[model samples]
Target: MEGLQLIATGGALPGRVVTNEDLSQLVDTSDEWITTRTGIRQRHFCAEGETAATLAVSAARQALERSGLQPEQIGCCVCATLSGAYATPSTACLVQKELGLAQDIPVLDVNAACSGFIYGAAVARGLLATRPQDDRRYALVIGCEQLSRLMDMTDRNTCVLFGDGAGAVLFEAVEGAEFAVDLGARGDMAIETPPCGPIRMDGRAVFRFAVDALPRTLHAVLDATHHTLDEVDWVVCHQANSRIIDHCVKKLEADSAKFYKNMDRHGNTSAASIPVALNELAETGRLQPGMRLACIGFGGGLTWGGMLITVKGSAV
Candidate 1:
């Protein structure tokens, strides 16, 4: 009743699955090398007619169905993405039109790279925190990205490290369902950021940043929520690399069983990673009502964030 609660979640991926063998034909990397380094075997790419908004609409519609909410009932739409399919039209507005949302409904885009989902979640949290508890309503937050289009097919380093996908969650204010989100950006690390033109990465440097940043972010979020490591049931982080995930868990001394990962199928979808991972946890029945879930992500922009959340139910 006082803070934002997750009501439902939905995710969408491309119909086409690009395997490492397929990538081997396009680049010099092999399936074994890709899997050893990134734990990604395959990932989805958007089909002919599936743009960002189309995938977003598909996800939002499923979230609405799970939440039992009509199109007009939503207060706003928040889309977190980097590849929005256009330079001018906001992807949020496109999803709004596709959903037939009300004219006055606000829709905005957040471009925080992989941290976008938690950033969007924090935005919805702030909105809920400001509104009257009795009248506070729902906001659809979706993290969707089409990284396949941005990949440099010839660059063996980055080509096999990304895929396209989308994931969505419905948030509303309710008692006992709350989150403690901690976010930060390192502007000074701008020199280390990826290029603006295409996907470029210093895998070793990124590995170092993730190893250092994630543990601290996790502690900050845990402290903000007054939660102990033992209290957390699941850790749903951006599926960037299995090695980074392992390193972060070791740094936090978190239970290995509670850390969820499925990057073997979906590479770094950038902003879509965490939500897609969350949706996977939901599908597997690992993320359940009354469970405490922590989400953490780091990506380009040299940005990162974490959210310590308490789930209310499947149908909040």
Candidate 2:
């Protein structure tokens, strides 16, 4: 059996758009200062009544519809997020409830920071494999965050680097597909969240860790799949910073165009970044059938993960 099949992708962002100029009014930062460092021009903020669970459900609905599968057909639900509406009921459980997915299926949320979607997908695959053999076992994997609520808006450092969003991908277990994954953690606290306190991050430390982690995970996944960088159609890394991605592109001597960047538009949505970018690519018809993609993510927990997949389904 192929590792996992990507059936479709979906994403959601808050209605409120926060531009660099808008953030400048809140903090002692300028448009130039923010863009030069993070390459983020704008981001979204959840208005009242919009939570991480809401975004996750919305994204899941779209992906579920695109897959053309009834709610009862979904066998698993995995959500990746650092921010959830309620600590008790996980975001993935909420997706299952909102989407009316099967109650007997495994549904849970995982926190791997930005590397969540990769880890969640891996977890979903393993869980689905244990179920009764079926023609096509479908799983809904989502990454969502309402980091705006978790940040000290007055603190320009961490505040300016995040956005609120969610992304979801429908995965189906199919024969003859190709999927490989590599996951690791350094057990560092370069980024952390205190109990009932705003998020805290050592910018320099996390930045250093990310640059190193991205390439390591990328190579690990490629190696596990016995593939080369030259064969990759696109490299979707965590949308943390422009310099971090640019550095890797040059270091590996990979095609600059192959590295996709939407941080300029959405900033870092943590766990949601990679899948959100995937949804954008799919919606725009840029990600099509018969393509190979390498997705990498690095963030808090000092965690990192990479996955290589051969596209077998089209979004449109």
Candidate 3:
């Protein structure tokens, strides 16, 4: 059997594109204000008929096709989101129905804000460890959000910073794979939950927390994996801002050309950022066989995580 594998990934967004200029017409913010502060020029928004689950299923379909897997082959479904339309009926269940997954397959939902993808991945990793050989064990891990649903569009501050989208990754149980995972949370840093609506961030505060926490998180994962920065081929971090990306690379002294980024095109997709970027990289043939990639993310709940994986032979 192969070791735990990120076989393939897929991402989907609403057809509607919301440019900063378009947002300016709705709110008091300017294109300059959004660009200067968040490094976001535009983002996608969900259409009238689209919901979080629908976008997630679209993403899952692409991933399943790329991976050559079927709905019944997946033993687990993990959905990561903070903006689901409902509070009950786990989003993963909704995905299971949409994907025609087996009734007995475990369905789980995780809410770690932007860090949700890493959290979902970690859960899928544990699932791989527990399943028996020849069990057809696989997990459909997704990070999705329709943040526009939570945005107080009347308030210019955060209205333009978020959009709606979904991204999915297929994790398969295999053998002979190298893996290192580290996850952390700071309760003191957490924003009050429930009724706070989705997320209301103090940009300055979150910036400080992220800059201080990410390096430590990365170092922890490196130490656990016994790998050095120079050994990494690609560093895929949450695409919140170009400034944050620049700061993290400088602090780690990572090679500029080796970093993978899509912020200029997608802005921030919240939980969907990393996997969306991963799919983009795979589609463009930027990530190849036998490469090592480090995935990191930080977000609300004041959480952060990092996962280091040695890319096995690629099928694409």
Candidate 4:
């Protein structure tokens, strides 16, 4: 087991709130169809000048402010996304520049689709471990996405299931805190985002993978940490679908109350899902200091992972 300061979390959604009724105009799907299938009632879409990097900065700024730490104190930045507006300046770099963070720290983007934020956190942990000189070792892990730009309205199957948003988790190292993580990737392409094309996904195939991944990952990290399902206060899975979480709850025979979800409003914001839900918990006063949580994510690259974290922070 390891430790995390878990300083704070913050989230940002686009200005354009597109409802299922609105999407019906652009595609052949209806609110009933999307709700019954994905449990998504609405989603946010970026307007002019609202790129992934901008959203990342917004979320990270909120987190930094809440943590009561100046930007220059941040030790590193890791942004996870599949929809960065540009390939040259990674979203993490843009966040560092816009936030006035230190220029010499590690700043890079990670791509593991829906499972990206967890990966980014692991990367940040490794990077922070290498720098023993820094006193406050804060690392900002951001999961930002702009999937609306890649939505193919013609293909209602995939188009109606994504949105644009960013979630930033800011944390530092704290001793005597319990932590465990497990990450894995299986070779598969049920979902993909091509270079010049829109999003493509095999919905049924992904559902199968997700349902299986959730419990296995929850058990993986929980077991590694010598904890049980009862010991976990929350299980925040990737907000991909309602049915997937429902099925996994039944499979694990765990309390449904422990699972937190927000996909209904945000849709599946790719890598932003879990951290976004965490931000919601914080904003709503649900996440508190010392609460035990198991966070899981699964998606393209067919990557999947989960980690156990004990919340640490002074503010709600």
Query: All candidates' TM-scores?
Result: 0.93, 0.98, 0.94, 0.98
Q: Write the per-residue lDDT of candidate 1 for residues 247-313, one digit (tens) a residue.
A: 8788777788888888899888888888788777776777678788888988767889998876666
In terms of TM-score, how similar is model 1 to the real structure? 0.93
Reference-based TM-score, model 2: 0.98
Q: Model-by-model lDDT, in order?
A: 0.81, 0.90, 0.80, 0.89
Clashes of each: 2, 0, 4, 0
lDDT score of residue 46 within candidate 4: 96
Candidate 4 per-residue lDDT over residues 142-169, each given as its tens digit: 9999998887878999878899999999
lDDT of 2 by residue, 94-162 (tens): 888888887889999999999999999999989988999864388889999999988999999989999
lDDT of prediction 4: 0.89
Model 2 alpha-carbon miss at residue 108, Å: 0.3
Stretches > 4 Å off in candidate 1: 129-136, 188-196
**What is candidate 2's local distance difference test score?**
0.90
TM-score computed on alpha carbons, candidate 3: 0.94
Clashes of 2: 0
